[model samples]
Target: MEKVVRHRGWQWLVGVWCMLAGHMACAQARTELLHRAQENLTRVIVHDIFSPPVASRIYLYANAAAYETLVLGDSRYVSLHNQANMFPKIDQPAAASHINYELAALYAFLRTGGKLVFSEPMLKDSSEHILAGVGEVDEVIYQNSLRLGEMVSDSILAWSSRDNYAATRKKRRYAYSKEKGKWTPTPPGYIDAVEPYWSQIRPVALDSAAQFKPVPPPAFNTDAASDFMKEVKEVYDVTRKLSKEEILIASFWDCNPFYLNTQGHLNFATKKLSPGGHWMSIAGQATQRAGKSWIETSKVYLLTSIALFDGFISCWDEKYRSQMIRPETVINAYMDEKWRPLLQTPPFPEYTSGHSVISTAAALVLERELGEGFVFDDRTEMPYGLPMRRFASFTAAAEEAAISRLYGGIHYRSAIVNGQKQGRGIGNQVIQKIRLNAGIGK
Candidate 1:
């Protein structure tokens, strides 16, 4: 009886040991997976920010979706650092950190299957952390570090790489650009002549522009704008209604980008590269040189699309919140109905320009990723089928195009300015919280 009892005890002990070992192995796997997901999310964020506008949008959305899935698993804490590290390389470290924290907390709540709420103090702490960590690095290097983190994470976790996704996306963008044909250029003399007139009215322009400044909820009235002001208004209105003053208190908080009808006469005449123009070809060449695979290259385009759409929504919300009258509304009331804007007005409010914000924010993010001094020849086509004009910097091109909306009489100058600021804010916020497993930030 004693021998039988000892045998039973030994078997039970062995079984317990095996179960413990299996549990440990599973825990390790979960940790590694979480870490890898966090890393990939970082990379995706960096890549989306640095890539072309279209490409960035696509990747941003996909990254967000993927992150959402990962956050639901055992490795969810990996995204905790995202808020601390998002836009860690930008000049506005404090703002970036704040955004990162806000997003991280939101993601945490989501992962916990809890309700979402924005936390201001946490975001501020995150900004401080990032600033302290990257105090010495140059802006470019700092930005690259964020990207490197992503690359490392993806590689270790076996996620898609930027090069591979970029290649396929580039092909599609290139095909679209080809179909759009060439854009006509604005003459040097015309630009020069316009500059003097623009200078003379600059003060009045700035003053008038102040009226369209981004207002928080309760102050902004979406009902005042036309029904056509759907997309642009949605972003502004939603943000104002949702975001608290604490959320808007950051130094770089005002740097959001806006959109407007730049497709008018000036845009056509400038012969600048349009968003839909030969982006695919440019991306393709870049991808091939890097030796990226198809899955990786395709992600570039996917992210870009996502960003663009998100920008549109965000900007629209802003407009709705402010409910400020559009240039068309004011101008038409005073001027002739025949005095139409150079570009067809988008079906949204004119307070904040969605395109201006998205494009500028995208440019800022891309410039950081691609390198500040790096210049690329832009042979891409423009809207209205004109020849492409080259630019030294993506931001410069986007800025010019954004301002052109004012000159073309499609948007109030103030609207474009505010839009750009807002767009940058949104982009930074979104970029910081991207984790491979966590997905898009709240």
Candidate 2:
């Protein structure tokens, strides 16, 4: 009887040990939870019609909140408080708290994102849906995890509040100058320039907004043989006789947030993912392919968002400084009175393509994270009805993105080329600046 009792007791102890081991693995295995929360944030950003620049801001803060939570809760990861210098020191939970870092990271992302968007109730509904799907958990661990999440998100929110976004809102709107070759609102919607003062916002890693400034745009001359006119003619000619392949490529890369469709006086607005949102989705997809743990995935999003956050600041500085005109506006006025490009031009200056700049920056950072020559199928456009496109490498995808701006007729070749140069510099700078996940980016 004593031997039989000892055998049963040993079995019970082994069972409990297995359950504990599984619980720890579950913490790392449920990275999908974080991705789902990020997807929800993207949905809200689309619903809100956030411009690309503003969408980039929302992405960085939400992702930073999640990333910072992991750094605080997980000892495997190093804290970026002093490394990045953007995040301030945050209070942590008690040392022995049985916290679930995965749940906490999701909550941090949701809470920070909810504060940035207008529709809190929508985010609230998604939050409940996400939380309901989590696996069974002890009530004590659940409460402790959520408390830590709030503490981390609150610290991120405090740091973001002083980036000068509010002060720019109080400033007057951008006024279009009557000078020749200056940018103005484009047709189809004729919306005013989006985020003209975005350069004034604080940068995350860059020393200043103009840290990666490109050379001045081609001289604006109307003479038929002039460099500017030659560039202008190329756009008019290429768009006029676009191939089926060109159309598909242009449509695939058109990450316009809000586009107006008009038909005989019945006009409505259509919403799509912003440029930054597309890259964020790609990172999520790639990480899943690599089977990265939650800690690795968190760092990827944080670093990619940092590149995009600073890329926009650098690009916008040159944009408003040069104030070069868009292709559609110039082609219609000088080349052909009724000439419209194959794609609708976005409402912004054309000195540096935002798509080109941010895309290259994102791709460079992704290469550093995922590595060079990493091939993957890009399904980011599938949600918008486009087919999957395969890439041999991150650089290949980035080059395609830069050329897409020209094919879309939204950018001069100079803008796309220079934007790539600028983006490359920003990407290298970001990789050099961030310290966590060492021996990886280097």
How do all models score by TM-score? Answer: 0.39, 0.93
Q: What is the C-alpha lDDT profile of model 2 across 114-198, one tens digit per residue?
A: 9999887898788865654455556777777788888888988988998989898998978998999999999899999889999
Model 2 C-alpha lDDT versus the unseen true structure: 0.85
Off by over 4 Å in 2: 1-28, 438-442
Per-structure clash totals for the candidates: 93, 0
lDDT per residue (tens digit) for residues 1-442 in model 1: 0001121343344435546778443233222222222223323323222222333333333343333323322233243233321211112123333232212322321222111112323333333332232123345444433443333233322222321333433332111111111111122121110011111111100122132235442222234464433423433333234333223221111121112224445442222222322332333333333343322333333233333544544554455445444445443443344444444343334556655766665565444434445456543332224344555676765676576555444455557777888667654544443332324445
* lDDT of candidates 1 onward, in order: 0.36, 0.85
Top-TM-score structure, candidate number = 2
